[model samples]
Target: MNLVPLAAEHVSGHALLPFSVYAADGRLLLPAHAPLADVRVQAKLGRQQALFVQRADHDAWRRGLARAVDKVMQSNASLSQLAQARPDPVPPVQAPLPGEEWEHVVLALDRAVQAARRDVGWVRAVQDVQAQMRAMVCRRVDEALFYFIHTGSRRTALYSSRQALRCMLIAGEAARELGWSEERIAVLDKAALTMNVASWQLQDELVCHVGPIVDEQQRAKIDRHPAEGAWWLRHSGVTDPAWLEAVQLHHDDSLAARAPSSLTPGQEMAHLLRRVDRYSAMLSRRAGREALSATQAAQQACLGTDGKPDPTGSLMLKAVGLYPPGCFVRLASRETGIVLARGERANAPVVAALLNAEGASMAEPRLRFTTQAKHAVCTAVSPGLVHVDPPLDRMQALHVYLKSNGPAA
Candidate 1:
């Protein structure tokens, strides 16, 4: 039977009894009668460090549950032994920001990634489909950047897809800027995803580094994951030698090397991937460090005289744009909203402000051409300023606000 674990609170109208069975050797695999009030059998089970549904559908999960029960009976555990208090209620979801479609798309893709990670078939399909999708996004980004190089447009286009997609887009943009063709782009895309596969190999403490203080040496070791990650990728049957080579040399600083030298097209693309990966890491809401602003990032980029970002900041700006769309901003009236669209005008596309800092509905969003408004100003409030994480619920609130307030006039 295929069954995935459904959250306990979600369990309803089903009459379940605590029962157990024994094995041929008369050994207890799981307790027989789990006390309904003592030890709780949560709907979740850790399958390879990732949670899997042990009772949702009617396939493997159900079979696993039955097997577990059989083990319990053989062990001679009583029903009361499995009883425990229900887990605490999950925290409320945050509302989405007004006009933040891209964030919503990215969040949805995160759910897809989680699902794919749980199912092997889905994982394979994700990799295959995302490879092609990555190429498309990369080509698009290159075109956009080429336009920027000519027109000096302040705005840029951004797409939110799986990690593979993100990597592809970043690598492709760099490749195109450097004039690499379709074949080279494929090599870069392969390297980008494989370089980070074993990211799951690191423990949470190491991944998060949630200790008292991490010394410089430890930090350096953690930073070497790309090199280690590449080794793992190569071992995993990644056939693209050029891709693996790029991955290994991505973080190395031997500008003067042997095999094609360090600054070759493939190596340069890999270097760009390294920067994008670092930028993605910082974008995540990690504890301890304050998030940086785009303007701050731009300044940081200036600090590096390498014609690229001083140390890897420019690609982020190139990827996300100087003023990223969906970015939340406060108006002159102190109203809050996210960017809704991009425009060719010197300033302004469209914005949909939903609230005031005090948590009041905006009087109404007044659409002013960012360039034509009395004072088109943007405050540099970093994402860290908000304690609550942005989510769909937040956007629903803005949707309600918009439905009530009508268009930004």
Candidate 2:
């Protein structure tokens, strides 16, 4: 018997199975001769779950399956070619004015976190943030990260939302560079933002804990967060299959190990999200561990725990740069600054010097071009190393400076 998705609206009512339908895992979902309702279809899709109906007619089902398989194969072939071709280095886009739109995102995320107990309102808040992010154009990922980190550090005691936003921005950038369509990129952005929402409390605790997790119960909850978050989104009325699937598999590393030939589109996006998530975690400062330097994070990401090369690692490193935006660094000249924009080379980035060689805070931020060896980045520093009278104001001023300098080529 040929199995087909229950969501194909064009299928005739007569074509549906007269017998009970089971999910892929053999769980009975729809009773015999049940009429397919739009709500039911949506709920199933929201979980990134699928229900299959056995074809009443074998011949037609075979034909449909053959066509579906062929299409997927063709798409995979094209993706393979695209992956092999080295993408040209695109100049970094200019940072957009972080006025109302940036504030809106922060507010929306805050509301979402607060409304998590109320599922519908929380989902609406998430959608609001997604809409704002989709509407935002030509904004540098680093700029977004800077605003998110600075704002979140001051506004909330929890770091989950901040980490979520960082992952979202990083994943969105990677998706764009990979030539994903805007719609797909938006879905990715939303998925990344909500990937850890279900277990925020637990995650916050774990992030603050020193060393590795020794509690099996806590470890299990952390491991199950992705699936739990996907379930919550489904119950909250999320109907996009791609968004659901990306969230469900965001923590799965096995997808990265799979050969491209055997991978599905959802798995491909999941690979990207997983890589970005790992990289973002490394750059973030947890309670006991200082944030890894951009260069160190890049190296760790490129070489996985098992010593295997990650397929998306190089792309992430290139996109983020050796001194990713929002990161603190000390220059060869003994000055300290925040990375402003990616330079022509991955190791070279434009930095806004906040401290002079003597460790005194500069009166105003000075833009330094790291392409010149004399002003090269000496080491990635932690934020605690330097003092800024008004941290957020200095960051904003640096953003304005980068904006005025034009896009990096």
TM-score versus the correct structure, for each prediction: 0.50, 0.68
Q: lDDT of each model, Cα atoms only? A: 0.45, 0.68
Best candidate per lDDT, number?
A: 2
In the range 1-409, model 2's lDDT, one tens digit per residue, is 2456664333333333334455664345554544445567435434645657655533344455556556656677676553343222222223345444576566568668667767676887887777766555344456676655434323334567777777888777777677889888878878878888878878777777888889999888888988988888888888888888888998887887689778676677778888888877777767767667666677777676676545577677666676777777889999988777777777888888888999888887888888777788889876545456335555665665455455443
User: Model 1, 210-282: lDDT tens per residue?
Assistant: 5455576556655776677566555545556677767776666563233434366657766677666555443
